[model samples]
Target chain A: MSQERDTRTAFMEATYRALCTHGYADLTMQDIADETDKSKAALHYHFDGKDDLFREFLAYLHEGFAETIADHPEGTPVERLVALVRRVLDPVDDSADQQFNTAFMEIKAQAPYREGYREVLRRFDADLRTEVADLVREAIENGQYDEETDPEEIAEHVLTYIHGTWTRAAAVGADVVAMREHLVDDLLDLLVDGASVPVDVDATEDRGLAAADPDEPHENSSEDVVDPR
Target chain B: MSQERDTRTAFMEATYRALCTHGYADLTMQDIADETDKSKAALHYHFDGKDDLFREFLAYLHEGFAETIADHPEGTPVERLVALVRRVLDPVDDSADQQFNTAFMEIKAQAPYREGYREVLRRFDADLRTEVADLVREAIENGQYDEETDPEEIAEHVLTYIHGTWTRAAAVGADVVAMREHLVDDLLDLLVDGASVPVDVDATEDRGLAAADPDEPHENSSEDVVDPR
Candidate 1:
């Protein structure tokens, strides 16, 4: 890598460490500098100030997120979606990742206030929805989903579930681990008819009904219907 | 009401007005005092400080939310659940309420950082889930829903949708009014089988399918069948 690019990467890495230690509210450039081999003066040369550096950090995180999504491409749309969520939801015992998740929530909480954050967040949300919508399209093409399903709304549904999980994580004592175990299967059932995961509902309700009506098709999710408005 | 209680209520109302103006980050006691006819000294006399006053404001809001839920009991569980969402989503174009929603989101964003906000938020979320779970219980008892469905998970699904809507509203350019029109029927279909609403889904997918599968019975959502976890 170029020397300039290497320095920038190191700066962000130091900032991540400092952010994990002091959190967003108490994070300081000096702390980040101390976390790295770079002197405080060296840190000041790359960015204008704290907000500028933080904005760059957010950009870095967004790029990383997109790369993670691109790197995992080994399964069907439903399996891929579930795997993506599981990867995020079932992180190993990594305190840094947990701290990063907490800090990310703090940053997201600012999306309404900061223009930079808003643009990045809007794009991120839109990108996620687009990916899910594409998956829905694939499912429909494969005859696993109903032709009448509104891909955008299905996309929104998945995004909403993910957002809700984030919301609960922000709350005290949210059992993300337990919810992770159930959410993916629930989502699969919610999205594609007869596509079963390991959830209990599959055994009693979905499989039972699948047996009863062998030719029943996928559900249209009600959002695909006419609009009285 | 007693004079003391009236004073506290007036103080909370004034705080709400001030918060809507300055937001949570920059709010000051002087700003709140200016919003009320009461002097700053009188405000200080009632509460120890800003944190104390803000805690009371949250409590007031929580109480108001509880009252709002209790006051609206016009329909069946599914209908009542849909109506509750509609009421929150389809407010009249009152800028004050809109501003209040924005301000409420700001305070909610602070819950992770502030103990007072965290407690209030936890209670509010728990209460909402409890109410929905009780409604789900009623649906089962009345034969409107499947007997084997897990009320807690069903409740979580609805609350997650609402929470996700709140998250989206915190973003810029969120078209909540447009979403409110469709989400109610979408939610109904996910939770209960064969229940129709005013949404065009009633005319298209739902009612059409209700007519098609006259004996298809209720969908227990597959995830409800077995809980290995």
Candidate 2:
């Protein structure tokens, strides 16, 4: 039994590597077999087909995330939540993990018609929201946050931040690790400080005029405006 | 010359409809031709191929966005920014536009190998940041906001929030319009009131204990957490 479980684990690892190196659009079972040095028949025997393989892969990802959050050290709920975000955005040297994530998203985009894929993605998203919400509620209860705090709203915000950061980072080729660090810091800042302020009318007017005529091309006005990081 | 332009316009309109019904992944030039009721020869005569069609579509999208921004009524910078975000979140109900945006993201995920796609996407992202930053700076200069404000950082944060919100909304089938309204309100709150506060310790302890063990599933203890929306 142990040996059978080991083979399945080894297959999943190889499959993940292959999916990363060669995108889901291009991946084939033969490639997985070669990567794992297992017979194609052996792969078929363990999993029904490519879809099955992907389903299992997603399961592994969710399980891993749950395990990581479960093992986080005892600390302020905010600290623990930050740690969770870091783990999700953890640095990876190879493009495999990154590619894997992108591929997962692509598959998700097709989920309206792909019921199985949709189910898996929904569950994963729910799991993330629930866990984050729990942490936020705990923080509020412990008086780490204001008494009137809303956990669901905050959880949604954090989840949105994570998704947005991942999409933008992937889009721009920015260092994922650095981007994740910056995001966590900003999120923490927002949660603690809360949003309420006086509007800056003059600044608002200037920006309004600038974007007024998108066709009127303006020279890059300020060097400092560029993202230094 | 007028006839040629009209034909081009017609082709673009037809192509847009087809794209909305069928995503970019399933899109083909032949389908575009069929949708537009133009012969394949006509399409070939006007543009190179699938890649060419996509390129032209992107150019149109950028122009459309610029035009929309330019045409918006004069308003406070925050109001204008809010308007821009609204426009982006609301799908035009035009097939071509939806397909184009979807394809744009799909291509973005695979951008490492597509120089043309990367070039356009980079400029688009940079422009969004610059536009927002300029607005924030102008607001500060006009004394609408505190002098200690960092317009660039705030701009990036706002842009990130928008992008993240839209992506998740698309993934989960959320009402884009409703989400946009909520987002604008939340963002305004955050901007007016900055994020910074002391940590809550007691809430931290309860959350830590609950999340400490993955093997032990805890019953859902908190029912007070409700969706803010």
DockQ top scorer: 1
**B135-223 per-residue lDDT for model 2 (tens digits):** 66655665554455566666565566666665665455444554454444433442333321111112222211112221111112111
Error of 2 at B84 (Å): 2.2
Residue B228 Cα positional deviation in candidate 1, in Å, after optimal superposition: 44
Q: List where candidate 2 sits over 4 angstroms from the true fold.
A: A2-4, A45-48, A175-178, A190-229, B1-4, B91-104, B175-178, B190-229
Best by lDDT: 1
Q: Tell me the number of clashing residue pairs for each predicted model.
A: 8, 22
TM-score of 1: 0.80
Interface RMSD of every predicted model, in angstroms: 5.3, 8.6
Model 1 reaches an interface RMSD of 5.3
| Candidate 2 CAPRI level | incorrect
